[model samples]
Target chain A: MVVRGCENRSVNALVVEKQKSRENLFLIGVPCEGILDWHKIVSEVGEAVTAVKEDGQNLMVETRDGYQLLERADFLHDSCKRCIHPNPMSADILIGEPLPEGDPNLARTTVENFETQTIEDRYAWFQKEAERCIRCYACRQACPMCYCEECFVDHIEPRWTESGATPAGMQGWHIVRAFHQTGRCTSCGACERACPMDIKMTYLTEKLNHDMRDKYNFEAGLDAQSQPPFAAVTLDDKNRFTVRGE
Target chain B: MNHILEKHTLQDLLQSWRQDYDVYLPQKMENFSHFMPLTETSVLVDGDPHNTRIPPKALFLPMNEALVKFTRFGGYEDAKHEIQSRIVFGIRPCDAQAVQLLDTSFIQEDNIDPLWSERREKTITIGLGCHEPCQTGFCTTVGYGPFDRADLDAMLTDLGETYLVETFSEAGEGCFLGLPVASEEIYNQALDIQRSAHDQMPVAFETENLKGKLEQNFKSDYWDTVSQSCLGCGVCTFLCPTCFCFDIVDETQRRERVRNWDSCMFRTYSLEASGHNPRPSRVERTRQRLSHKYVYWLDQVNQIGCTGCGRCVRYCPVGLDIRAMLRQAQTLPFEVSHAA
Candidate 1:
């Protein structure tokens, strides 16, 4: 298996969950740059684009009209813009030159930007982004952590959320989807890039990731053996939701 | 009914109809263009001649809608949602054509869906021809065009500071009744613009024997190779202008029978209640999606199902181009399948 930073983390997490045997796996790891946003390129170059050649940090785009030189960094997807890790942490074989580590503050700013807004403003922003959802589940399908045989949304007898594109239904899908990735997310930004509506949702998961980091001093999938806060049971645990006479 | 509508006067004319109809036009969303209702402060999106991120089909079929409302004691009633008359102005020709194609499925004499039929009846489409056709679209190859007038009530040709409006119906003519009739010289200039715009689009694929090739090669390894990178996401079908499959669900909490958009690309779409999926994997799902458009639609309607609007080509997560797929399908050796 070929593993980038996110894919490597996903594999480690899966191994911890007993979904795969690490002994049987041979992972070829590579340093990552980032995934480019196709919409950004199409928006700038228009659909007349015949071909795009990725040469380092520059994109030589051939359109029906003429040629265009586009800066690759300018067109990176939002989640990739704030990536903290670009190199696979654990692999059997490491390939290519390791890229420079991304700053943690960039990911922090994304969470902070959403968290700083008023509760109503936060809800409004969420509502605006969520309303564009077609209930396609493209995000779930894109995520490596989301490998459930039958998804909760697909269940009929005990419907967890409204089975429509109404406001409530859409909101439930977004919130619950992020919640499922609480300690499992590798911050790949594949979900955001996969969206047809181009709805920004990594912020929600990033917020959960921020909370996991802050409360439990935990980061998911750093190694093959480290258990995530949500997955492991600890003797010393803190809880604000459930009443406990400690 | 050819007339000249000055650029400055277009907004006021749109505003005047607000008293009677909900006028929809493509306007700027966060980054891309979207179909938004005209308000007093609405500014029309311009500069790029491309289709909106969302197709106009949303105006008619909608992503989801309540078909029936349930009462306290198991009694059910028609949803009876009031649909207002709407003017879908500046709809692209490809999108407009898609609606007309969908009418065959939704509005057949033997079987009629009330929700879709009612919405279709209430909306009027006015097409805005693409002066510079989008790079991804291949309407010409699919027997449609950048300036197709088959389903539009009125078609507009961009003439710099003005629009050359050609109305095909009484309702379309009524919208621009007061506009001055265009002269022969101006009409000829508009024709030149339309022709040049049409000339810009290259035929994406050879439709000749393409359907036969796909139908014959149902079990080819080509499906596996092509569908390898596909994330099995619904991005392609959901964004598609012509893909109109939906699933009905009984929402007990909402007390309504709602219809939500479904896609063949979904594993669950073909999944039977007995824990068996007819189209088991992404390969089969991808084959169904492409074949339905290329083979099935042609067999049913004698016309290609895809409008070649390019939403699937543009929004595909894996960057799977249907144009490229169809062109590659042209190379596969044709053979008769016993099942066929």
Candidate 2:
């Protein structure tokens, strides 16, 4: 059930192991940093693993250094922490520990509360920072939680948002980003981390995260089994959208 | 509301919680800020309501996360992501509400995102009420306030010298059950102070028939007029606490498949692989943005999609006042339609 130093061990081992075990097997591991590429990993061992599995359903490889498991749905999306299907749908052997608890490096302050002297001053500071955005979508591309088949930005029939680096376009982009991740975002920090312009995109998500927690006592991605707050409704759930009482 | 922690006793409480659940608190990084795991050295409480540049959403829905990785062929695999029981400390009310709102999108009947559902299941939230409301905060205007208590297992209000912790859920009560208990007199005093603080909050927005107003003004000339000065920078959306929309794309690295976050603002955001662009004009795109929040989200969720956190207002480069836009929408002489 174990192989070492196969040269193609990372890729080949899965196929080899599946053939011998005659059972559905899932491989979870990080690509070797920097040097590791998907093609090499697949070419070296992918074919061999597939040949051995019955119905060719037994062998599968989850790439991304084990982070794909965080997305428990289909393989169409990525995972922030581990493979989406780290646990076998129906298998005997399991791999890796469950995702750890607690926020890794969440900033505690609200971006609005940051002292900037005056509203005009704060706006100016943000303007300068936002002006640096190139509309590259690096933040979007880097996020693991974005799993829409057709994003609003790309929807042509109804055209939900625009596509450009202009301020309005950028506003459309960012607003949609924050709004989409509302209850679903796990706050993995990948978007801000991936932004080439370093636009501090996390500030938006953080603000929303704060709001969700404060208003609903709900935190996204905290549990796999519980329904999202927005998707499920209770009569007692505070309706922020409801008319306020004096 | 009145709970006493021996100067460092908060650390002990955090450690105890850590044993059973992952405990998170705000920590300062060189020049930036973040919430890290609570350790002996972690500072438990501080008085800065400044919205952290990073939302706790990553704890649930991470960027560049792996939903599933597969070989080129029909070989299938499943991700074994497990939900971790945890506690988020010092969560602001706006962010708290944002998570609640997010649930509406992710946990919906037809299309529930499994990853978000998992994280939402096991986590308990402990919110820290705003002791000093931020200048950009207009939660009161959007039917929220500096210290709104819609979503929190427990809430902590700063009372000058001590923290008045109120348990709103059984889980919140359990969080404080074994820890030190607060005196009733102190709790009453903290409540009194919180009431005063709530009353003193000046930032407000008028939401009277706001959704109806937005619907009527969907095609108003006001959009072009208001957006005329807009530079189209995404600061407003990127900074707003409640704006959430994203795109997903698949990429291949060394033959391994990958999916990543994509924004609607990009020229390619709407350009399908077939080369047709839906939102070709900036004006059309702008209209979509405003209407989605004011009109669409409200219509779908029966909730206005904004919390009035003012990150959008404060961060916008061109001073695109969302409040002003909404206000104008309110007064516009347009017919409201409920038809889909």
Candidate 3:
């Protein structure tokens, strides 16, 4: 299995989880060069790219009229830029020379950048992003960690979220889905890539990942032996469930 | 009605038209031109007419449309009561013809779709003739051209500094108020531009024999091999201009009967309540898509379902090219029909 490191928490968790029962799992890791933001390319080209060829670090696109060149660095998904681990942390067979570590401050800068905005601005941004969601569950389907046979969104008995393409429904679906990933989200950028509508949904997961790292001192899928911080709790774990005054 | 509008004059016209109509122009956003509502800051990039990633089909048939709204207390109510009269400016010729094909699929039938027809009636399509057809589009082969003008009320041909406008319907005639008539030189230049655009579009394949080829090869293994790489995503059918299939889903709590766009590629599209699915696998769904577009569409609507916008070709996560499949389909040995 070619483990797309750091961003592939869902797959990593699954593989690690499987290791408890299954023994013969071999992992071949490849250093990720960051996934291309195809939607960015589509938007830049001003038309659907009929033909695409990658020449080194450049993407050559053929539209109806002519060719357009896009630098790969300019069109990488935001998660890829924030990804700290490109090479697999624990792989039996590692492919190619391990690349240098990504900027340590990338995740903090991204989180802080979004954090600097006012609550109203943040809400407005969320609403704007959520409104574009068609609720096709492309993000959910794209997620490797979202392996729930009966996703809460699909539960008609309790009905966690109403099945509508409205803004409120979209927001509910996204927030709930993103929350489900919590510590497990490896920031793989697959959900963003899989989305046909090109909704930038990784921001939700990335924020959660930042919080997990900050509060719990946990980064998911780094070690197979250790249990997920969220799953394994001790007396020392922070009990913030009570009201502040109480 | 037949006047040359200077390229700069278009901004003024659009500004004025924005007052009366929710004018949609192909505005360049991050990567592509989308038919978005005209804002004060909107700038038109007329160099490549094929710039818009998504077709203008959303003007009539929206991606997710609610058909009937029902509440526990208030039975059922019309979902889309307030239909806005809008103008879609700078839509490509292929997409324009695709809209006409949608009219055939939805409105021209005996039992016309109320929502589709209502929207179609209110919408005014001002087609901008493609100077150079998109490489993926084979509209010329599929009974249309860059400047075919199948059902466009108005057509604009780019003639360097000015646009040669021609009105085909009353709506087109009503769009202009004080524009001067085009000179003979301008008209000839428009004609030459049209001729060159038509010639520029390289036909990928001949569609004349496609229907026959598909009809004979229903059991062909080509579908299985082609669909092997398919992710079974709805990108193709959802983006297709003429695809009008919808799933009428009832929101129990809200009691609203919503008609969301459904794709045949999905397993649930053909699934029955009894747990039996007609299209159980990707192979069958892929075959159905090919047959529906290339074979059944001709029989039902007398037009190919695909306008060759190539959105499916470009957008498919798995890179499934219909043109390549069509080319492959052409080579398959014709199977003997039982009726024959």
Which candidate's lDDT is highest? 1
TM-scores, one per candidate: 0.95, 0.56, 0.87
Tell me what fraction of the real C-alpha contacts between chains A and B each candidate also makes: 0.78, 0.02, 0.18
The best candidate in terms of DockQ = 1
Q: What CAPRI grade goes to candidate 3?
A: acceptable
Q: Pick the candidate with the highest TM-score.
A: 1
Clashes of 2: 127
Per-residue alpha-carbon lDDT of candidate 2 for residues B106-157, written as tens digits (9 for 90 to 100): 8999999888887888888888877666655677777776677767788788
Question: Please, what is the whole-model Cα lDDT of each candidate in the order they appear?
Answer: 0.88, 0.58, 0.76
Residue clash pairs of candidate 3: A7-A188, A43-B30, A43-B31, A43-B32, A44-B31, A46-B31, A46-B32, A46-B51
Clashes of each: 2, 127, 8
List candidate 3 stretches off by more than 4 Å.
Answer: A6-10, A17-26, A38-72, A150-159, A225-227, A231-246, B18-20, B28-31, B39-48, B71-74, B206-208, B212-220, B252-255, B336-340
lDDT of 1 by residue, B1-340 (tens): 8999999998899999898999999999877788989999999887657789888888888888888999988799988788999899999999999999999999999999787898888888899999988868999999998889977889999999999999999889988888999999999999998999899889999988888898889999999988989988888898888899999999888888988889998888999989988999999999999999999998999889999899898778778999998989999997546325
Q: Candidate 1: lDDT of A119?
A: 99
Off by over 4 Å in 1: A41-52, A59-70, A235-241, B335-340
TM-score of 1: 0.95
Error of 3 at A96 (Å): 1.5
lDDT of 3 by residue, A176-229 (tens): 988888888877777777766667677788888888888878877776655666
